[model samples]
Target: LLELRILLHGPAGSGKSSFINSVDTLVDAVSHDSFTTEYKTNKIQKGEPGTFYPFVFTDIMGLEKDTNKGVGVEDIKLAMKGNIKDGYKFKPASTISKDDHSYNNNPTLNDKVHVLVCVVPANTIHLLSNETVTKMRDVRLAARDMGIPQLAILTKIDEACPEVKRDLRNVYKSKSLKKKEFSVSLGIPLNCMFPVKNYHSEITTDDNIDTLILSALRQMTDFGEDFVNNLYRPTSSLQTGI
Candidate 1:
């Protein structure tokens, strides 16, 4: 099985569930409400032989401020256990001290996160509050600390104006400049960001959303390649035979 532990984190109502649902229709069962995914996994099997085995996707509750003090954080830690079996063991998100709490769970400096997908609302490109910016920055820092490859998904693009879309692209290009500035002020390296428009469409034609989603998946595949290259060198002991 080509197992991957992909994390989807962002503020409430950022379309995290929607993005996961777009990847596979089966995920729709667990996608709902503002914080519907307390903790769940959706599996997609590639029907073709010689192709990668089923890909399991774990969806956790949205990480809010003070999530570590709540039950939701423990749920995320529990989910990490499954990833450990897949060769990626994350430090339990629950064990981190309250004072040292971070948005992204960093079990160790050498932690290998296959991919970190940060969701942002496309309609509100520059509508982030001070607290939101801080949280976003911390996520970026945590990804950097774990040496994980990362990408940003700008959701709800259909609801955004052209001007907002342009601004969103610029912010993405600048690593959400305001957040990047804060990271720099705090001495954190910014992770690379990519802007993807993930939306649900009524039409099922060739020009429909499936194409866009497939493109996004391809981008993720490329990012995964780079992450594996960085965290596990070809000559390293961790290298797999597959």
Candidate 2:
């Protein structure tokens, strides 16, 4: 089994769960709530045996402001610490506290996350507030701190005008300028990024949605292959008996 721990992180209602569902039909259990995933990991088998086998992907709880101060912040923190070598095992329900209604704040630095997928809405990119832009930039910074490869997926593309899509990409490119100094400080390249148009159609195949997804997947695989080859070692203890 080729286990890959891909973490999806973004603001609430950014279509994170829907993206997971697109990757694997089994993730349909996910919903559209503000916090659809409450500190849980859903595993799915990607590709076939022998060729690529089943690579594991985890759908993490969506992040929000003041998450660290909330009740579930601890759980979120813990979940974010996992890496490729030692994949995540779901936490038992009995261990969770019923009193904590706030989000989990338990992010651990040891979490071995392979990739960080940031979901952004294409239509709202230009309209985001300065604070939101800063928050998005912070997310990228956090990913860099964890040494995880990061990619931005632009969701709700079908809802945007063609001109808006063009403008969105330009906006994204310009926004990188604001983080150029930060990237330099971290010794990370700022241009290693890809754009994905997701949720183009209610029907997966309509409006060339599959083509967009495939293009995005190609970029992701390229990044993932390099990340896996350079940063991680194969785990011998990963038994397929489950």
Candidate 3:
């Protein structure tokens, strides 16, 4: 049995790493001034020992304003197809080639991304560079062509909306978010986007935060399972004769 692989890609400081830490306590050390320069896969441990959730998450270097300053679009495309291996350092100059030691000669279904999740900071969504948005769209197109399920997590909702900052429950009712505008800007459907504030300075978890994170996670697993199941589904129709 293979765990479903969910790939998270977004611009630097979008809270991709923080989101992972919030969900599974897998710390990747998020920094606004720096970018994650490696490809890493994270797993959620269950209550029991030597056991984990059925799904895993893979995070790549954050997308940047320039292709040469951050993760290459080609590299993200390669990752979607499972061409890149874990612990591989990202090189903004160029994508990994088949000749590279980190390249996977043959990636199985498990190695391929079952779900493609785009993590974007709610506060900085409007400030995203045109080049970065284009790169994101390019990666999204690749994932779509591969028939991978996709979703977008809008992180740092509290910072984006004052109402939500006061009360987490008002997240949906807050008018300041302008979900439609962001949906159009990011190229992700309004329904596919989920907004949540990642745990930052909190010494412990909060029920409200956990609720939002778990909701998104549930959808991730659901979409991932559907994608994997559909792969084995028969393309031809079955006929029954009386």
**Which candidate wins on TM-score?**
3
Worst 10 residues of 1 by lDDT: 81-90
Error of 2 at 239 (Å): 20
Off-target runs (Cα >4 Å) in candidate 2 are 25-35, 45-53, 65-77, 83-111, 129-131, 162-204, 232-242
Q: What is the C-alpha RMSD of each candidate to the true structure, in Å?
A: 7.5, 7.9, 4.4
lDDT scores in order: 0.51, 0.50, 0.85
Off by over 4 Å in 1: 25-34, 47-54, 65-112, 162-208, 229-234, 240-242
Give a tens-digit lDDT track for model 3, residues 25-93. 423233331367899898877777688888898988999997588899999988998899999999999
Q: Clashing residue pairs, candidate 3?
A: none
Among all windows of ten consecutive residues in candidate 2, which has the lowest summed lDDT? 83-92
- The true-versus-predicted C-alpha distance at residue 231 of model 2, in Å, is 2.8
What is the TM-score of candidate 1?
A: 0.61
Supply the global lDDT for candidate 2: 0.50
Angstrom error of the Cα, residue 91, model 3: value is: 0.3
Off by over 4 Å in 3: 26-34, 236-242
